[model samples]
Target: MWFNWLTALTKGVLLMAIQIVTDSTVQLTAEELATLPITVVPLIVRIGNQEYFNDGQDITNTEILTHLINDTELPKTSQPSIGQFLEVFDRLGQNGDSVLCLSLTHFLSGTVNAARQAADMSATDVTVIDSLSIDRGLAFQVITAAKLAKNGAPLEAIIAAVDLHRSHTKIYVFLNTLENLIKGGRLSKAAGGIASLLNIKVMGEVVDGELQVAAKGRGKKFLNKQIDAVIDDIKAVSPAKVGLTHVDNLTTVSEISQRIKAALPETLVTIHEAGPVISTYTGIGALAIEYYTD
Candidate 1:
């Protein structure tokens, strides 16, 4: 059925079909993956001596959170191996299709580099894009590329559209604790300890592919005010979609979702649990909001 749709759309105009590929960091459910014309390569997550794939099926964000809470060692995530990328590329291009692979930000992960390296070695025609963002922010670009590809858009057109979506997207994360940051070496132990002693909650935003501290304060009220400010910022733009992702913080994410929905009722809104790869850095009680504007 999907092949028929592709054939009908590209019948006389295109030489070959375009295939979409992305890493597991993108915020998409198993059902969404099943229905969408896209392929995902899973990231590897290791907790202590155990290794799990961030494929949503083999491992879940909840299970990762449990280990994060109970285990002493911080979880570590690795990008899919070059061989993994080659496998997907070779399989997808078996029918002479062109593959477009999107990966999480280079600053956060080495996935894009690996994809590019694999593309060089594989016989298939493959293009790799560094998404420059993660979670739903990355999904905005990947899903847009998939939709355009499915509709028979040319490779250049799909890349252009994806870049446009990327420019229009913003991601903000609220960190509940600094323990992960310290353990992951994103923040110094001294700084994290000082912040923890003060009970500070940090707000960070993804900018130019790097996470930067945007704001900080103590308590829920400060976070609420910051969220309201973000809503106000959203009102200033023509928002297309808003996503809320949390690491074991449904209550807070739900409230944030409600606030966004109330402000932009017509815009598409979705909520997801952050995957293991993301949870490894964000830790428990973190909430991330991804905003895509038209």
Candidate 2:
């Protein structure tokens, strides 16, 4: 009877746990965890969703797991450095639960690869997942996985959940400057030039685990209008559960967030700034919006 009551109570709660480290954060559901037989979670550095982090204090920013990448000059490692991920693994392993690290992408950063190396080096059992998308496109997956693991789901089942729900998410980004992409080597100079020539405001959507350009418009002034059009398109397909993120763009953040809340009050809306890592590529004053459909 006690066990049955406990199960019911756990099911009733969100069963979520979130942790913050220097420049990123990790959120998981304590109810369903992948690393089994070991009940303690420690020494783990939750990777930031490779999205933009905002720097302004207009909103309460505490407990969001933001890291400082503001003007921190570091070599672009096409992948997260092995040393970086290893530190977290070693710490998490201290508690006897094998380290389970999350990676933003195998697409942009070798962050997951780095985690593999770290796990090998430390000989700590590790599970690394390539969310295939950045920001909350990946974040929601992490949250879902955490919940499953806490619910006593095996690692493989948790990973399957991550992959399954990831496919349902949509991510969109509109950047004011392409230089950040070029500077971080995420985009080619030619593509940047072409986008600039037409004063292109990009509209990207996550499809099949990749961020595909949905449309390109000619000016910053047309951005809001363009986004609205995209929203209309999404609505035609289905209603969406969305998340909002920004990098030094308060006005756009507030404007779009307000507009979205008005249009879809039933959707869960969250706004966060790009932490230092993602900011290095998207630059400040950029915005990313993400959502999901059934």
Candidate 3:
């Protein structure tokens, strides 16, 4: 059911049609969305009494950062409802087009589960994929699938290619503050307080669909060393694409981008601001490095 065919009357031919769908956590620009054959379903972010759709257009990351810095209540994010996914799937598959829906890791969110439920309830042939990643890490896979679909590749080939890319992709995050973690109940208040008093920074990696802290140290020197290590690792792999995403941490992210470009001139590098759902958890001054190897 993953593959669907449509008849073309021009030459009496049968052509394969596939549609790419993903949640808004994937870091794609407006231009990319307009140009690519990909559709995004948005998550919801609630701060106090106001609710915002995380589609970038409904609420900008800048506004989210300001609220996080000043608001008393921490922002809350929710996965898109099954009905939302069902609507998208139904529309895309209305004309005999099979749909490929990729979602954020279920470890961090229930988006994949919602997508799966919607896929089952819909009449269309829908395949839901747990990307096992977020942001640019997820975007890389979505873009790859869209490109393959546009070229009329078979469903199996698209899935295999996406799997290969996912295997080679790596995500590393540096948390400049532990306040969000503590507020979100991910870290104990006592532990976060101690770390904050010592001005500690946390370096984490996304592995097996979960974030695991890899290192912790104090001051700018420690942060620099970790960034250097990440850069060195990227150099070792000679990645095909490097994406830098952050929540209002432009200076540091820009520096890392320059270093990557200098070292890997052939690689494609992109810079994006972390969206609301991501910003809510990352807090201010958080940077994420997404690397995809050849």
Candidate 4:
């Protein structure tokens, strides 16, 4: 469906063309990213002494998981520098095109600030927006803006549409292990140790630009109940769109996708492998869902 849309866009004339820019944290598939009118600025990823750019390049979720399983130092991620964003903004705007920059939550990373600074330096009209969510949640807003832009919608209209989706969209994360959070210093060592001792599964939601616990329990059954409750909430939002992402956890993703599909047959679902920035926090075997509830 997306391919066909792109084909039509290529064949038709566009009166108002807008360029969409987003960082690598948005969990969009390579094919999807290639097909859209979007430019992705790679985030900086550091593992041990080696450095990688998430510019749709050599790094992948599988490689990140392998490092995690080997007990290598927890991967560290950083936002793109202002210089990097300035370069991308200049390239994408060279054709006198308007650019809309969608960035991951400012609370989680300084990528948004970099984009904002670059926008101020650019000669073209650029609007930078904080997605307030990462991974597929960020993907949701980027995709919506791309579609609106493809239809020749003005930049302001597309920005308004993305902002609306950002408000309604939510990301739910199910952590299969507490070690990553502990290693990354996101969770206190003491708290992580307690959760591990009890065999607890942590569930959290990205709210108000931060990840916070919504519910958690002792076993997978409780996780299933939590998934069901999330599905119920999505159902209440008529004609909704949903996205699912995982860090090398296909079994859990398949099960959750089946449940969500069975419940909301008409809802659109996009499944993606979590990218480097997101995988750094989610770790191996983490499953997440992103959807709109309005």
User: How many clashing pairs per prediction, in order?
Assistant: 0, 25, 0, 0
Kindly report which residue stretches of model 3 are placed more than 4 angstroms away from their true locations once superposed.
Answer: 1-13, 185-199
**Residue 268 in model 4: shift from native, Å?**
1.3
Q: Residues 4-109, candidate 1, lDDT per residue (tens digit)?
A: 4456455664467899999999997666677667999999998777888889868886788888989888888788999999999999999899999999999877
Q: What range of 10 consecutive residues in model 2 has the weakest lDDT sum? A: 17-26
- Write down the lDDT of every candidate, Cα atoms only: 0.84, 0.56, 0.87, 0.80
Using lDDT, give the best candidate's number. 3
- Model 2 sits at a Cα RMSD from the real structure of 7.9
Q: Which pairs in model 3 have colliding backbones?
A: none
Candidate 4 residues 183-218, lDDT tens each?
666566665556655658888888977777677688
lDDT of 2 by residue, 112-160 (tens): 6766777788755676656777776766776666555555454566666
For candidate 1, report its TM-score: 0.91
In model 2, which regions exceed 4 Å deviation? 1-80, 197-199, 206-212, 233-240
RMSD of 3: 3.2
Q: Model 1, residue 61: displacement in angstroms? A: 1.6
Worst 10 residues of 1 by lDDT: 1-10
Top of the candidates by TM-score: 3
